[model samples]
Target: MSKHTILGETAIQQLLLDLPDWKVIENKITAEFVFRTFADAIKFINNVATVAEEMNHHPEFCSSYNKVRFSYCTHDVGDKITDSDLKIAKQISELARNLNGKSGY
Candidate 1:
């Protein structure tokens, strides 16, 4: 087993409450927001990807025109969720919010 296995739904729920802008989705947390244009959304994802890549984490993302949805969970640890997942989730939420002056999520 891995550290991610230690987290349960209740713990995840509390973390989600504290994180306001992110939502827990089973083992993944998702955040979504719409941008001024498709180009803007793509730029935003690229920026987010840079931070995620640096952290050795990545998001499962989808884009439709100006809308973007991102899901994050650590993949190395049996695709299980962990504090690392929540940390990155919060960090991504903060960075994206700061960039646009809104949570966008």
Candidate 2:
């Protein structure tokens, strides 16, 4: 497998500008999704799982009754944010939007 590049601070800042719901928390790009019900939240997570499989990049998430918090970072890239992290973050963001998951839950 090809090595992933670690994103520079400036590039990460620029990417975050476009990703309004995402924030740099620790070493990961993190976001939270709020759903009207637990089932909706789980459905959204299922959608994300498919995307992650396709992209071969998985994220860590914590789910409550009606909320899910996603943390994205490339473990292969020294656990730093990389282009893969940004790409997956965007996809997850879109999935959340389509599932009617509100941000900043």
Candidate 3:
């Protein structure tokens, strides 16, 4: 399938199996990462930015004190989930794991 093609429910479910911390919510695959401190959270976000820039696939995120929630979807494809989104989500999850970011707030 094309990278930008919208994923169906079955495909999305299969993809999410490897991403235990992520879930489908309102058409987006999302996860929340909690860091020990606000600075750490910011650091994770910055790292994510670099990776996203390299991939040219940015995620929607919100950071609070020590928690950051990241959501991924292909807005150009009707805000639907796609392979590109899953790829970025995997990278983001790996980054969070490397930075000691806990999977939920």
Candidate 4:
């Protein structure tokens, strides 16, 4: 397993081009998704968990009813957004797209 490191400003900018929905906080990348219901939110979390497991990179998350807040930061680098965070952010966006028409209720 490779440890995650913070990306340079230029690299971060390029990555953010693909993830305009995500916000950068103190160099950490974050995004919050809202669903139609609690069950839907849970399902979304499950999907994220699967992706995280497959990539061996997890996120800090909070959930309540229809909202799921996901914050991705490489703790190995003192909670800074790294290439890993950008990669996962893109993956999460893909997951949302895949579930576009099949949103849980």
Q: Comparing 2 and 4 by TM-score, which wins?
A: 2
Off by over 4 Å in 2: 1-3
lDDT of 3 by residue, 19-72 (tens): 888999998999999999999999999999999999888989998899999999
Clashing pairs in 1: none
Backbone clashes in model 3, listed as residue pairs: none
TM-score of candidate 3 relative to the true fold: 0.93
Summarize candidate 1's per-residue lDDT along 1-105 as a digit string, tens digits.
654544678898898897877786766888887777787778788888888888777789988897788887777776666787888777767666655624455
Q: Can you give the lDDT of residue 47 in candidate 4? A: 96
Candidate ordering by TM-score (highest first): 2, 3, 4, 1
Tell me the TM-score of model 4.
0.82
Candidate 2, residues 1-105, lDDT tens digits: the string is 746778988999998999998999897899998998999999999999999999889889999999999998888867889998998899899999997989973
Winner on TM-score between 3 and 4 is 3
Please, what is the TM-score per model? Answer: 0.80, 0.94, 0.93, 0.82
Q: What is the lDDT of candidate 1?
A: 0.75
User: lDDT for each of the candidates?
Assistant: 0.75, 0.90, 0.91, 0.76
Per-residue error for 66 in candidate 3, Å, reads 0.7
